[model samples]
Target: MLLRMPGVYRPQGDTRLLCAAFHDANLPPGGTVLDIGTGTGAVALTAARAGAASVTAVDIARRAVVTARANAWLSGLNVEVRQGDALTIAAGRRFDIVLANPPYVPSVVDVDARGPARAWEGGCDGRAVLDRLCAAARDLLTPGGTLLMVHSALCGTEESLIALRGLGLKAAVVSRAREPFGPVMRGRADALVRAGLLEPGDIDEELVVIRADRAITDH
Candidate 1:
């Protein structure tokens, strides 16, 4: 079993969905892979298994970093784990592939709070971290590199596509799935109604996997 310390966001549907997306990406030989908001280094491990030359994972929570490191060791995978905001840690680095399953649940409270909540809360609009990544991702991608990210459609899948395209990447919804609302989404169902993101009785949210590629000509 993968090692998990308390407070780390456990791997779930979004993680599995992104894992499937990774199967479709064209990873370069001996390529470098970066997993943002990695919890227990699940995606990083998958990347290593897929033959990525090197894998690095970053998470904002200290517990998550520790848990991910432990899991990597237990799995006998060479994954570098670090603790920092996804955007900050990714700055000044370029990767052949970047993967993320960021915090997208619209929170009743602003997402600035630390603790277990930090793992999922993304403010009223739920794009707090995702938006930042769209803006900052180009700096972290080599020309022709790809970004594979997953999030709830409740967070505006179209918005993310538009943002990434605006940054000059070729972006599109590569895959989608409807999943039963998990604890966080279920608990915030009322607030989501108030936020106009859900209907009164909506019991599920669609998740989407988006792929964006930096053109080889971007250089």
Candidate 2:
């Protein structure tokens, strides 16, 4: 799957999460898993391959949903891919583990400008999407369930911790990559700087990846 989709970014494909989910962590054999923003369904499929009993891959973009479903079928993995915004999706659904590689790019570009692709934009300072996801994640996770998210380091680790705390989740940096901002992000940063939404020096490569978990307290 990674070989076929070289352009799309899949955080679950990251060595850290893959290694941890498969080799490091104690994922119960055949447990259920959820992959938020399941681009190409790499993570969800991988989880299924790793013995997850059920995997649901959700994405906001119709194209992403189609691509993910196609990939799942080609891989012969039983993954359910659906098109829905994470923020407005129905509640009462919970999972043993939830994985998200949301758009963490902070920019001033209006989300409507990019249409459906805006699902990957993190707004100015890059925490807009992250903030919303964290809030919603609290209700989606089962007790003792894990929530893994990949985010930019430039957004401030402390800030992310704070946000997670607000949602009753604990956050920690799971991996760091000095990745270059993509073309769309580069242009957005420049425009935002010109518009005074960001400082010129604030634009640069950033460390990306924050894997978090929701605590489970027994009664």
Candidate 3:
């Protein structure tokens, strides 16, 4: 069981889906891994247990850093949990595998309140954090390295692909699943409908796992 501090994002469907995809990725063994927006270090622990030579997790919330470090300790896994902006922590570092499950829930405002909601509330278009991550994917990975990310389809999968590809990485959607609206999404249904992000009767949203690989030929 993972110890979750209040306000830290709990592992849910998106987490499960991302873990599943990671298991199937068949990445090179003993690689260095980076987990951005790590919550309880669930995904980071997976990498550590999978024999990654090193696993580093970054989160903007101090509570998340504490929670993830606690989880890693409890699980006897080696995960370096840091509290900071993902891009800032990743500067000048390259990992053989990069994993992300950033905030992708479109919200009326940039963020609801600043506490727990920051974990899920994406800006108006839901690309605020996702866009930045996609933009940095190529730089975060070593040549021929892979990036695995999960986000709601409401965030525009095509846009993410285009961003990664434009950066010279081969990108594609590797997995897709339909999930019922959660409490947040359910509550925002009306506003989302008005914003044309959802249909009147649409009660479910699709989650997509996108995998982008840096070309071996790229310097």
* lDDT leaderboard ranking: 3, 1, 2
TM-score of each candidate structure, all chains considered together: 0.96, 0.80, 0.97
**Ranking of models by TM-score:** 3, 1, 2
Q: Give lDDT tens digits, candidate 3, residues 1-219.
A: 999999899999999999998888875878999999899999999989888999999999999999999999999888999999989989999999999999999986334558888788888888999988988888999998999999999999999999999998999999999999998998889889999889999999999999999988889
Clashes of 2: 2
Q: Where's the lowest-lDDT run of ten residues in candidate 1? A: 105-114
lDDT tens readout by residue for model 2, 124-212:
77787777877787787776777777666655667777777777777667666656556665767777677655568664555545556
- Which pairs of residues clash in candidate 2, taking residues 3 or more apart in a chain or in different chains? 106-126, 107-123
Global CA lDDT of candidate 3, please? 0.91
Higher-lDDT candidate of 1 and 3: 3
Q: Give every collision pair in model 3.
A: none
Candidate number with greatest TM-score: 3
Q: What is the lDDT of residue 70 in candidate 1?
A: 89
Query: How does each model score on lDDT?
Result: 0.89, 0.68, 0.91
- C-alpha lDDT (0 to 100) for residue 112 of candidate 3: 51
List residue ranges in candidate 2 displaced over 4 A.
2-23, 110-112, 189-204
Clashing pairs in 1: none
